[model samples]
Target: MPSSSPSAGFRSGLTASLPITLGYLPIAFSFGVAATRAGLGAAEAVFLSLVMYAGASQFLALALIGTGAPLAVSAVTLIAMNLRHVLYGPALLKQAGADARKKHAWAWAFGLTDEVFGTTLGVLARGQHRFSERFMFGIGLGAYASWVMGTALGAFAGGGALEGFPTLDAALGFMLPALFLALLLSVLRRAQLPLIAVAIGTTALVSWLVSPVAGIFSGMVAGAAIGMIRAPRATKGNTA
Candidate 1:
């Protein structure tokens, strides 16, 4: 049985975050290496991890900077890339419901990265443990720390550190997405299949026709629309 005690909750959350921390390390290291190779100093690379903290977007930022894109343009692009994050807090809190206790949400919510949100939601949906802000804190702290540490180490390692490990370099690209997909699958339900399919199709189509960024944004919008349409039907069926 899961304990509701604060200490237990924190410990459990920290334990649960181990997998995510592991996943983040190599990816963060990759980002750090990439950033440095693009001419950023180790401190600057680590600073990006500290403030931005966004996984893919951090890489995107490096690309934009490397290309000498205007600061305004880079800012807008990064914001657009991360707009999905705005919905994460509400989605999470809604799933947690009114009783989940969010007195510290303002702080812990900053750590609700894609992996963190998925892991938290999966745990909550599975009813493995009662919601605890302390748990959220623990999970967030573990992941954040690993990401920062990984960035620091990688930045110091220099860009050529992974040049000899072609296989590992290729594998890192898909690791985060694979982890997120697995987390989503853990909480998958039949009712969500259509939404997923639609989202995938929309994303693929837009990416082929336009740009990857457009594809991602369109897919999110399409999925949200589908989910909204299905909500009433799901609610009605449950009440029937």
Candidate 2:
């Protein structure tokens, strides 16, 4: 039932991505604003977005360029920043069947970002939505379109736009984490509550004790291990 798509499946896909679309607009706008402030022309800003389409990395690259970093160093830094994105794909791949994992599906892998990954993971965890290419397309396309449009708007608005709406800036600041938490809560199930608590507790504790990076990676690894260990028990309980 969870994997089944009804008559309005495409619409469902689009609907599922609404939160992400909303979350993307201001941040992408911020990127455009940043690009311009970094001395990039509007054309260059839009072009950078179209070519790179990487959210944080785009900002970092622009900053690096502004600082007169060498091309190779800039490239390597941007690439390194994006390496964590590799962690997003395998989980999604396992959820996809061979046919669904066709070349076309893999081709759009570039669209996968932290926000999209979390939303998709949430959807999969809920086990109530079809994770088809069309669905994934909606998730990716909606976020992509919003991001590009927002960038264009920001480019046109320039830096003053963000300043004009101070609230927008604040909202954009918290968009990613807010969206991540919202997605997590939306997918939270009673059965998974304990594990989620463990993951959250561990992440918070580690982040407080160490660095944000250490906390993030440790939380992920620890949560995954716990989930795996509990799966067999869950299966046995279900069978009984």
Candidate 3:
């Protein structure tokens, strides 16, 4: 099938994003439940997913909010957590390029996340799918819709649904981590092992010695610095 056709592109993107959609359901649901349990109103929980659109950040925000963290602290925490995403935009923009980077680039930028980034990168890198706004929308919208639905359900239900299911309540915290792990493993590149190692080591060491928030930011900075230092300089006729 020609990936340029709107219908074909959307369908292909949707099909490719099914697993990510499924994976997001439970995690987002948990976020909703956690948000509500943390004293946020149902609308607030849903709005978090609607506006923030960042899964882990949503959870962290709710946690920070619940704990009475000041606005500045909450903002700083989220910024630290998402420092890694700074590296994703340039690469994705380069790959998707003109195909999806015209009038819709701003909207597309809002939809970029770890899973979406990985899926887009994998497809583009393999040249299996043509990049298009419709295709990217299909993938982003599917995941976004699923996440919103899950959030609404969990926000409304709260602990009521899991009252007797203690085991299920306990497992909610695990879902997001598992999802992130799966995405990370899928996107792992052999050539990036050294960078990955440095990031992980820094994260662990700083987390133990300082704070997890500091560790996350420090880890990404350390890894990025190492990557730049080890990067091969641009040469004649070489795009890399």
The lDDT per prediction is: 0.86, 0.75, 0.78
Over the full model, what C-alpha lDDT does candidate 2 score relative to the true structure? 0.75
What clash pairs does model 1 have?
none
By lDDT, is 2 or 3 better? 3
- TM, every model: 0.93, 0.79, 0.82
Backbone clashes in model 2? 0
* Per-residue lDDT over 46-81 for candidate 3, one digit per residue giving the tens place of the 0 to 100 score: 999998888878988988897899999899888878
Instruction: Please rank every candidate by TM-score, starting with the best.
Output: 1, 3, 2
Candidate 2 has a TM-score of: 0.79
Q: Candidate 2, 91: how far from true, in Å?
A: 0.5
Per-residue lDDT of 28-48 in model 2, one digit per residue for the tens? 888888888888888888888
